[model samples]
Target: MNKEYTVTDDEVGTRLDVFLSNQPDNPSRSSIQKMITDGAVSVNGQTKRANYKLRLSDNIVMTYQPLQEIEVQPENIPLDILYEDKDIIVINKARGMMVHPATGVYTGTLVNALLYHCHGELSGINGKIRPGIVHRLDKDTSGVMVVAKNDFAHNSLAEQIGSKTAIKEYVALVHGNITEEKGIINANIGRHPVDRKKMAVVTSGGKSATTVFHVLERFKNCTYVKCRLLTGRTHQIRVHMAYIGHPLIGDPKYCNSKNKFNIEGQALHSLNLTLNHPRTNQQMTFTAPIPQDMQNLLNYFRQTI
Candidate 1:
């Protein structure tokens, strides 16, 4: 569908991509840039770059072809739902489960399960691929996660995370003993220039990321720590810990060597989540118990350390 807008006085001087992203459609900046590059968007009847500054009363027309809807089939995959209400559902997402389906992955995801559980109530803000997913945990990271049932709840929850009002805490077992009881890592993170599959602490052209950690227990060759995310970036906790010489135990991508522990993936868990209720405005918190694999590893540390 095609949409047109005249830049107003208040919108003058905004980047073209930024201005388009703020529209009601809420297209991603990357998507907007792609549209501009493909000549699907124009300012004053001429194509403009994503960084072009807007001028008041400038006519902007965007021709967006709606994505072909891929049917996200409902799966009866069991979910360990922790909390549920009319607006949202909190689940203790198990390890080894993808949050949503992507290309080449169409089933056995949290979204598929939610489709069955919520029964068509999931919000469509994230498109058909990631319906109701306000945020995500890694595939191997077991944790508490919340899903919105409606667009209103989805918007509110997304705002909370964007504004850093939602609190997310994790517990991780890393490969080295952390000396400090508590500390903060302030660094910029972005995609690795050489390795596109991984994230790294880049010196420039990266987003600012902050992670706070407190040592919970120190083992012979590992540290159990609690991490709070001040800014949510992809692989933020894992990258920050690795930058501090304590890459998470069993982390295949970040850690250089195989872990002594027989765990399949990184020993990281989203232990707690806190946020304000979207509808009621009441503060709420949810917690997930440590999974058995991590728990057994911790017990091993307890007996040996």
Candidate 2:
């Protein structure tokens, strides 16, 4: 079944996925991407990228059948909001919280908390079933993330992210003593040839990604590095760091057998995020303190061998 909706002024300047969340049945951003790839979604009769910015009065048409069971329940998960306004909210996502509802992760996700806090304010870019997800960080990576509250804000944020205007920075505890103070890792990142579940640094048949990193401190064996994302690819930082013989500490999937710290997951933290206000045209930056786990890892490296 297909339906058409008129974009109101509020919907203007928001991403299509962000806009869809405000509707009656919210479909998730991932589901919306599939619909877009399958030609089941259109804006003003034109097929556009998932990050397309919607304008006022733009006609949006979507074709999909509602799922028999919708499981996006509101959970009273704790949220650490660093910034919030009418358009968007920047959250300092803690480790152990999934970005959204996914397989094996139906509860205690950021989406659930957003639903609880925002209530009916989230825009439905995918559908009314899922709300307010623009971009995502890994489950184990704690950092700042932005959620769109309305369609206009969602679209505007989408444009900024798509154009690479969104400034994102991460602090990571990586294995190996990096000698360089600053360097850029320009490589092609793609799915691992043998491992479908992991990403790798490939020389061909992949997207070109550039990651600029600065050495913040050097431990006995590990290095504290600040990474600036030039191109946001899946597992870009981890893969690039690993490519240069400095895989993230505690990254079980990619790290070597002999690791100094026995942390739970990869030691990566999103420390900073800067983007333009969807409605205000003002630049905004959100800073997040390093999580306890990461800070402890650094402390361990500092104190012991």
Candidate 3:
């Protein structure tokens, strides 16, 4: 049996999942979403996605179900540490290493490595297994990611990122020689109209996304560009790069298959992150070197050009 929650003025306009997270005894937001998916939770007596906005007097009824506990086993994985402290750990995750576990890919992830390295000190965010994850990089996009070690740090880092107080920059090797020294890509990113698996810039009901890019170097058929994300949307950089007619090199999903060079995935790397420490109130900046694969591609380009 689950408890019923009546919405109040303070809870009005709050996302359903967020309201559920405020409850101490209820399962995590993701857990509640699973329950809703399984027809266990009802909003105004009807099922809805976890993101449904609550009104001042809506009825939220939930049937509580025990969630399966996740035992994160530590695997001896090598990590490229850029910086570490009692509150946070920044790592240069190698390409192809998923940030966290998913349906078919459980274990042997960055979370597993962090668990092993940090000795199980991680803060649970929204009740998913990603205890310390503040942001994410693509599976093939290697870069610097900061992981929180405790609740205070987790909350602070997440809030900083959400508020755009944290500065993040990426270096990418995109095809085509962009003549402009700097440019901005502004679009609404949403699920592809026909292909739900991919993202596209559309005029429909989509979130506003912006990316500022600067050309670092020019090649005969490619340009090395640096991107700063003003809004973090799924595949924002890749989608923006493609939308500008200069898809990333070796990007199978967005790039043209008739590419001249041989590479794999987008050559995007999260090179730098800067933010204020949650507990210390001291400004901190971290940088990670470009991964070997991206470096190799750049080296090849410099030689041929």
Local accuracy of candidate 2 as per-residue lDDT tens digits, 229-251: 99989988989999999999888
TM-score versus the correct structure, for each prediction: 0.78, 0.75, 0.76
**Residue pairs that clash (backbone atoms under 3 angstroms), model 3:** none
Error of 2 at 247 (Å): 0.4
RMSD of 3: 9.9
Considering lDDT, which of the candidate structures 1 and 2 is the better prediction for this target? 1
- Residue ranges of candidate 3 with Cα displaced over 4 Å: 1-70, 258-262
- Candidate achieving the largest lDDT: 1
Q: Against the hidden true structure, what lDDT does model 1 obtain?
A: 0.90
Q: Residues 1-305, candidate 3: write the lDDT tens digits.
A: 56688999877888887787556445446656777778887988998888889998899888753333555578789999998889999999888888887533558899889888988888776455677888899888998999999899999999999999999999999878899999999999987764445788999888999999999999888899999999999999999999999998878668875645555577889999999998898999899988788888899989998
Candidate 1 runs further than 4 Å off: 1-69
Model 1 residue pairs with clashes: none
Model 3 lDDT, residue 213, Cα: 95
